[model samples]
Target chain A: MKIKKRLGLILANTILIIASLSVLLPILWVIRTSIANRLIAYKIPPVWIFTPTLDNFRMIFETYPFQDYFLNSLIISTAASLVALLIGSLAAYSIARFRTGDPALRLSMLSTQMLPPIALVIPIFLIMNVIKLWDSMTGLVLAYLSFNLPYTVWILISFFQGIPVEMEEAAMIDGCSRFQSLIRIVFPVALPGLLSAGVYNFILNWNEFLFALILTGRNTRTLPVAISSLWTQQGVNIGAVSAATVITILPVILLTFVIQKFLVRNLTFGSVK
Target chain B: MAKSSFFSNLPKHDQQTARNLVVPAMLGIWVVVLFPLLYALYVSVHDWILSQGGIGSFNFSNYFTVLKDPLLLNSAKNTVVLTISVVVLEILIGFGLALLLNNKGIRLRNIYLFILLIPMLMPPITVGLIWRLLLHPELGIINYVLSVIGLPQPLWLATPNLAMLTIIIVDVWHETAFIILVLLAGLTSMPEEIYEAAIIDGASSRQKFQFITLPLMAPTILVATIIRMIAALKTYDLVYILTRGGPGISTETISYYIYKVFFVALDVGKSSAMAFLLLLVIILMTFLLMKVMQKTEQNY
Candidate 1:
């Protein structure tokens, strides 16, 4: 019995360690490839001992308008998050307090998240051309709201529903108007949900690819779109690609750490909670 | 001027006002989502290509033209193959990881979860790019390790069979943590008394798992599988960046096929037709999942 138990423990740990290593392997290679000297990166056996260089990272700035793409991603994601929050919070508040829409309407709202970007791309391509919003951050943010707004409403509804109403009633007794009470009371109380929702929306928008792929032009192209373009011109440059990949994902990874606790909650729509 | 007085009398009207609040967002979604959806339907039935001026005629020809092609059939099969394989692998790996971590008693479990989740949070494109580097036939670390073990290096993304397997492996690596979290949530929330009762009855571990854990975790499993299905069906970025439906279109799933027809071939009408086909599959899956989820919620 003791021998079997020991064997099980050893096996589980070995499996776990191996799994962890596999998860890290690709990521570590990307990091290594980013800093590896150009010659060493291409070596068949992959040289382990070598001088690391920042040339690829530097080349990103010199060779491409990486900064523009970077800035476009940053601005668009932030703007989308803010806009989604602005309208979504009100709608969410309404739904939480007043049970806003009928079942069909609410389900349709949720259904939009499941709508594939492909469904929108063809018409949106034509729509953007007619409106001349194609290749602009405004157009990208508008497209992003299709998903982000619904999500924001759903998440904030859960947060708002969880808050007790007595506090707002108490504010009403103190002569604050209904709108004032909402602003003064519920807003502060739901700040955590709002923050998490905003951050979540920012992450979604930041990672959006298909919309930006067709919607944006060369000047307004986001990072993912720009990254895809790397393959188009000529032979693949593994080092520059790796560095750009790391750079592109670095902020998103950092932001996700803050929202880790809220992920399952948001993902399951508070059902888990 | 008097917001409090305005709402003082009609509590019933508050609900009306609240419903009205949804109007702005509803309108916003309609413009972005529903309007374009209607447009897609219109486009799907017409002969349209952006490069060829526009909308040549109104007909069901686009649907037949797109659907009759062998590419759609090939991609549909690939989509099913990829989705089932990846989701199954993820569920198994996630369950194993969850059990392992649950048994570890919580101290180091979070660290493992954190690291395991890193792959999931990164941009799918970067996930593809980094893995592409790691799977490079010659210089990649994967081949390096295989050589060390005296194994033959298979042409991965460049080979038809291996390419499908390659994307599945990357997807499993990226998404298994999702199942892990869902199952972990279920595991942690399980009443300790149920397990204690089983233990007192001398229920073996596997017996307890089969009789209690599996039954209890079924709803969570369904939800996880459905969500993963939608994600897998809509998959574009990783396959786009990593495989490009390559090595004789072995990796071309529905989304990738639509993207090729829409962007590369510039066939708008056929692209929308294929898009709706994908959407119908997703909507049907989601509707079934939602029904089950609602039932589970009601029972709980």
Candidate 2:
């Protein structure tokens, strides 16, 4: 019986180690391919051993305006998210504090997120064309805001609800106006929720593909759209594609690490409560 | 008496005034989201390709043509298959990983969880590119590894049947982390006393899981499943990047089909009609899921 139990333990450990390796392999492959030279042109048993080089990185910069794409993505994602945070938090606070809207209105507001973005792209495209905002950063930002705002409101509504009413009430009693109390007292208390929402929205906008694809031309193309261009063009360069993927994912990976704790916390929100 | 009455009405006035302030933001949301959706529906029913001078005529022909198209049906069927397979795989793998990590004795639990989540954090295009490289039949790591193990390597993206499977596999890998993150939190937060009682009642491990954990995890599972299903149904970036709905249209999902009709084919009227149909399907599914979730929440 002792030997049998020991065997079972070893089996479980072996399975766990294999599972970990499976999860890690694809990421490791990306890092490896980004540095590989001459491996791209070869089809001979897929050599894993190769001297690493920055040739792909050098070619990527020379071939495209990667810096411009990076700046475009950064500016647009940040601007859209900040604007969404401002508008969504204010709306969420009012709805939570006053509870004045028809309940159906609030519910319908949340349901907007269920509307797949593709469904609205044509109408938006036409509208942007009519307004002369087509193929512009401003248009792309507006389009992103339309989707991100609804999600932000829903998420922030729940966050705002979790705060104690007494904190705001106490502030109100101590010569603070309603707006003042919200700004000075309630906002500080809800800072973490806002930050998490902001980060999530930023990531969403950064990673958005379809809107960026349809709405922008070369000058305003975002990183995802730019990376996608690698495939459509002739003479497919696998190494450069991998390099762009690595570069594009850097900001998001760093941000995810920063917000990892909060992400776990918020994802399980109503489950625990 | 008059003064007292005025003071008594102050709460009502404050509430009314607050509503007035919130009205602008609420209206802004409606104009930005709902108005465009309504307009899309309106335009979809008409022959309204922008290149053709816009709104040439109000007709049901566009909808009729799209509904009758064999391509639309094929795309819809492919989408359903993709969504169901990916969601099912994600749930199973996600639940397994969550349960494994939730075990108290698991070493490096936080590190494992963090590493597993990297796929979810990476942008969709990057995920696509990585998988595309890895699945390259001749020079890809996947076939490379398979051959090393003395296994016959399959052409993942080149074969039609295998192409859809490849997209599904990459999607499952990308999204299972999201499911695991949500479910692990649900498991950790579950009350332990119920599990302790199950042990005392002489339940075997499988029996305990079936009778206790499954039932308790149902609500979180429902939420995760619905979110995953919606995401899967609307999957475009990865499919677009990886296959471009290729291998002779075998991997074309509904969203990809709509893009082809609108952009590539420039058949805007047909694309709009297809978009409306896709919207209807999504709305119906979302409505059904919401009802189930609400019912489950009420029971809890």
Candidate 3:
């Protein structure tokens, strides 16, 4: 019985080790490739070790306008997500507390989440052009609002629903107005929900590529759009591209770990809970 | 309508508050999404290629143009195949991993979970880049490692047969973590008493899993499948960054095809029609998902 139990333990540990390595190894290789010499990139035998260089990173900054793109991504993602969360939370509160909007409102809002972005892009592209917002950061923000606002509203609605309505009423009875009660009492109660929802929206906004690809100019390109623009060279700038890839995703990786705890709960939301 | 308006009048303050709160969000949606969607329908009927010139009177020919195109059919077939393959593999592998790690006595639990989630957390563009670098025909780390192990190393994205398979595998690697998390949550939250009872009855581990675990996990499985299917159907960043509709369009899913038609082929009208079709398909999927969720809620 002792031997059998030991064997089972060993088997489980082995599978666990293999699974962890498989997930980590490819990702680790990206870090490896980014730091390696550019010439060693296409060698038949992969170089396990080499002198690391910051040349690729430097090149992206010095030789290309990559910093503009980086700044654009940071600003656009932060701004758009904030605006979406602001309006979405208001809408969510109204829905949760007062049962506002037409009966079809919630479904209609959610249906926006389901719309293929490609369909939306055509008219959006035209509208932005006519309004002189084309190839600008504002245009990208508006495009992002379509997905972010509805998603934020929906997620926040569920979160707001979890709070008891009587808490706000109790604050009201103590001399707070409806709006004052929301600010003093309800906001604090629902702060975590707002935060998790905001973080999720930020991540989504940061990761969005296609609209940024279509809408941004050379001056206003975001990270994902910048990654696409890397492919113009013929000989495969693998090292440089890998370096840019790391730069682009490094912030998200940091943010993801911060997000890890709230992720599964918020992602599966009402259904899983 | 009259009765509802009168009722609205009685709760005048509440109604004012509700409208104030909801209007910004509704306006955002109206300006960005609803209006564009309606305009897209308008554009779909006109021959507004690039929305400049070639503009003609409204007609239904663009729908026909999109439908009759052999490429759209090819891409649709590829999207279906890819979606089915990826979702199935995700469910199997995700559930298997969840079972493996669901043990209470596991070592380095948080570390393992964190590492597993790295692929899912990174941007899809970044995911695409890493895989593209690793799948490079001559010098990729994967091919080198495969050669060391005496395994076959066919040129991955460069070859037609391997391209689609490669895309699916990369997608699986990225998304399987989500399913695993969902399933693991389901697994851990499952009532422990039933398993204890089974053990008390002298049932085998396999028996306990089959009789008790699988049935309970069915709802989670359904949830994961529905979400993954919708996500898989809308795959774009990976297709764009990695394959770019290359190696004879083997990796060109519907989203990629839409980009190709509208941006590359410069046929705005036809692309919009296909886009609308995709919208209908998504709504149909969500409708199915809601039905499934409702059914499972009743059963479980």
lDDT of 2 by residue, B271-296 (tens): 87888898887888777666765676
DockQ of each: 0.56, 0.51, 0.60
How do the residues A1-273 of candidate 2 rate in per-residue lDDT, one tens digit apiece?
Answer: 689766655555566566667778888888777888845434456565667899878878888878888899999999889888888788777766666463555566556777777887877887888898887888888888886787676677767877888988898899898888889998898898899888988998899999899989866899999998886783467888888888899899899877776785444333223
lDDT of 1 by residue, B1-300 (tens): 343343344487575677677888888888888898999899899888878986889999987877789999999999999999998999999998988877753456677777887876677888887787777787677888899899998888998898999999989988887888878888888889999999999999899999999998888888888888888888888888888898879899888899899888888889999999888988998797678778788211
Q: Which model scores highest in DockQ? A: 3
- Over A43-128, each residue of candidate 1 has an lDDT whose tens digit, in order, gives 87778788889999998888987898899999999998998898889888887776655456556666778888878777888898
Query: i-RMS, every candidate?
Result: 4.1, 4.7, 3.2
| Model 3 error, position B214 (Å) | 1.7
Among all windows of ten consecutive residues in candidate 2 chain A, which has the lowest summed lDDT? Answer: A264-273
Poorly placed runs, candidate 1 (over 4 Å): A1-3, B1-13, B105-107, B298-300
Computed on alpha carbons, the lDDT of every model, listed in order, comes to 0.83, 0.80, 0.83
Per-residue lDDT tens digits for candidate 3, residues A208-269, read 88899888887678998888768655357887888888898888878877866667765654
Instruction: Assess candidate 2 and give its TM-score to the true structure.
Output: 0.93
C-alpha RMSD between model 2 and the true structure: 3.6
Q: Show where candidate 2 strays beyond 4 Å.
A: A1-9, A38-51, A264-273, B1-13, B298-300
Candidate achieving higher TM-score, 1 or 2: 1
Selected candidate, larger DockQ, 1 vs 3: 3
In candidate 1, chain A reaches a TM of: 0.96
